[model samples]
Target: MDTAILPLGTVIRRQADSDEQAIRLWLHGKSAHSQRAYTSDIERLRSFVVRPLPQITLDDLQGFADSLADLAPASQKRTLAAAKSLITFSFKIGYSTFNVGAALTVRKPKNTLAERILSHEDITRIIEREDNPRNHAILRALYETGCRVSELCGLKWRDVQPRDGGLAQVTIFGKGGKTRHVLVSQRLHEELCRLRGSSGTDAPVFPSKSGRALDQPAVFRVIQGAAKGAGIEQRVSPHWFRHAAASHALDNGAPISLVKEQLGHSSLEVTSVYVHARPTDGLFKFLNR
Candidate 1:
């Protein structure tokens, strides 16, 4: 740690003095997913700006943004945002005298939520096509819970408990260390119980053949293979199930607030994207053919 004295007799506490140290301090409390994404984004910035944190100028930031022209808008935005976060943190920690990231404008990215959503029939087909019990449960729980794939992968047997009327409640550890309870149907509950067998409470709800907790990539392959087997030509990922769950629930008249809590959304506006993406009714409905 270091300290700096200003002309006005003000002293600033410095937690980090270099770019690498600043990045580490910035990512200290972030989730694993965020840490990985932000690290990759910072790496992209390093590739463009070959200078120290304090030496980076607005011109360097702008040039880095320009070099991202080859990437998609979303990627560009995310990378720039990560750089901004890092540079901002560096300024806060007295590593840099100026917050150059503040001057760097991040362009808005395209919204492809609608294109990623799958229909009810497609979701059902993919689930039915999976013959493996573990993979089948994974697909069902993903759609049924509307949980992130990371949350599902980290599920533990102790997190699931039998509920009233043969239903079951699952406690999902979501983003930012938030936990939410989701109720599954009786059939799903039974399926999970059967899958649990004699495993201990600390055991993962979904385990690989080696008896370890299933990883995200393996679950992705499970869903992709199932989708292809069901004749879905387009690329399918575990996230599509989450999107489909939100859209389908909203389409069937489920309240947006309920969906928000179930999905662990931080805001109603985040949950409202599904309604906006797939509006069931509009002025076109009243048009006479």
Candidate 2:
């Protein structure tokens, strides 16, 4: 991958015969987002292990997993997964005789649907409070499309098709090089068009002043500030928009299957997290009616 285009903080440190070099080889085809995550996880394992790669044993890996204090369950899982991948690859490539990372097991974390998601009113208030057109558009895109921060940042004007009826479709390139389409609301379509004003199709839809994709941290800071500006007290991450999007769509009667496609999830079960937040089918109300 071109280092120039690599997302911020995803630099591939490939000194010859080093662990970093090995990681670069293993993550060769992964997206920048994936690379950054795995890199952090792998580097964390390095800090935990005192011995060399070949000297590390299964016990060390398990101990590391057990020692993940103060880490979120999702974070714990990814860190272990990364450690396992590194061990497996190191064994494959003769870095070690044993795949120690294989022996480590990660406990699946309970999904907290309510905490990670936003209410429709919350998202609306955040966007409405934002005074900047570009920043407001960014917040709206995250909510409307359920797109990852990287996907939203990577959006280009050419990837959007404005229909005669005013609605627009966006071709989003997601994790693992997969592509999916998201329908933009008429209001959002107009906002995007107004923000895009006369820019060439090749230009980024939300370019930084340097004429490149907006960095993820900047997007995060903007969203966090917007949430505060709108008087939201709960800690909000950019991904909250995506969770909220899935939940809100289903709440509005969008089918589960359609929600799955909108989210580019591989299975309905992955999309089913949104179902946890839905109101009961109103059994009492139905009887009363």
Candidate 3:
């Protein structure tokens, strides 16, 4: 902590001096992935600031968000999110007593159409085309458990638990080091058992070609290749599986809270993004009636 760097006057002044260092320290203390995202966000914000941060007016913040509208909706949303984070961080670090960013609003983007889930048939096609047993097991585990690619990559053999004389569940260390249990299908259990015979307990459940834990990009490639082999014309990624699981689970009447927990989301509002309401099944149906 450099006391000389501390600014005089209002909270905003102190924040202008201390906020950048605080944000950097805070980000460094977070997961590497999160650090990368937040760093990019802060840099973008810096580009938008015409004056010293302490001198940035509320109008400037609003104007920056407005300027983002011409970009892709996803990019706009990501930039807005980043701006919100920086503003929030500044407030937390005593840069400003009032949250000027909080008063600013961004338009909500239209939800993209629901992605096509891999039907049992589609799953079968992928599994059949995967000649590598390791790849097969990885896909099965993802499809069966709805684990995020990162969570699956972080998995260890010890995380798999056998119960009732069968492999029953897997303990996943999700984002933020939160742990949750996902039931493993009997077939997946058998696959793990076979895999375990060859790999060590401390080793990654899904290793890369280099024999290290599989990274997110490698997993993405595996899914892409499998989707291509299954004859899916649309691009598919690991996130498609997650969205598919959430949509299917909601369709089958799984409670929203449970789905939120499974997805490791901190807020039910975030989980609601996955629950799609059919136009034909809603109040619109009454109009037709």
Number of the top-ranking candidate, with lDDT as the measure: 1
Return the TM-score for candidate 3, rounded to 2 decimals: 0.82
Better of 2 and 3 by TM-score: 2
State the lDDT of candidate 3 residue by residue for 1-289, as single tens digits: 2111223543333434555675664575576667777788667777877565546667988888877767888778888877776776666666645557777777777677454555556766876798778888888788767788888888998888887757577998877878988776788898888877677778888877687899988889999898898898788888777767776777778898888888778899887876653221667756865
Model 2: per-residue lDDT, tens digit, 1-289?
2111123433432222556666777889998888888888888888998877767888888888888867999899888888888777766665555566766777888767777777788899999999999999999899989999999889999999987678999999998788999898888899999988789998899988898889899899999999999999988888999999998888889999998998899999888877866664767876855
**Collision pairs in model 1:** none
TM-score of 2: 0.86
User: What TM-score fits each model?
Assistant: 0.94, 0.86, 0.82
In order, candidate lDDTs are: 0.90, 0.83, 0.74
Better of 1 and 3 by lDDT: 1
Rank all candidate structures by their TM-score, best first, as comma-separated numbers: 1, 2, 3
In terms of lDDT, model 3 sits at 0.74
Ordered list by lDDT, greatest first: 1, 2, 3
* lDDT digits (tens) for residues 1-289 of candidate 1: 5775444676678878577788889999888888999999988888888889778999999999999999988899999988998888787777777777888888788898899999999999999888988888999999999999899989999999999999999999889889999998898888899899999999999998899999888988998999999999989999999999999999999999999999999999999999999987799879997
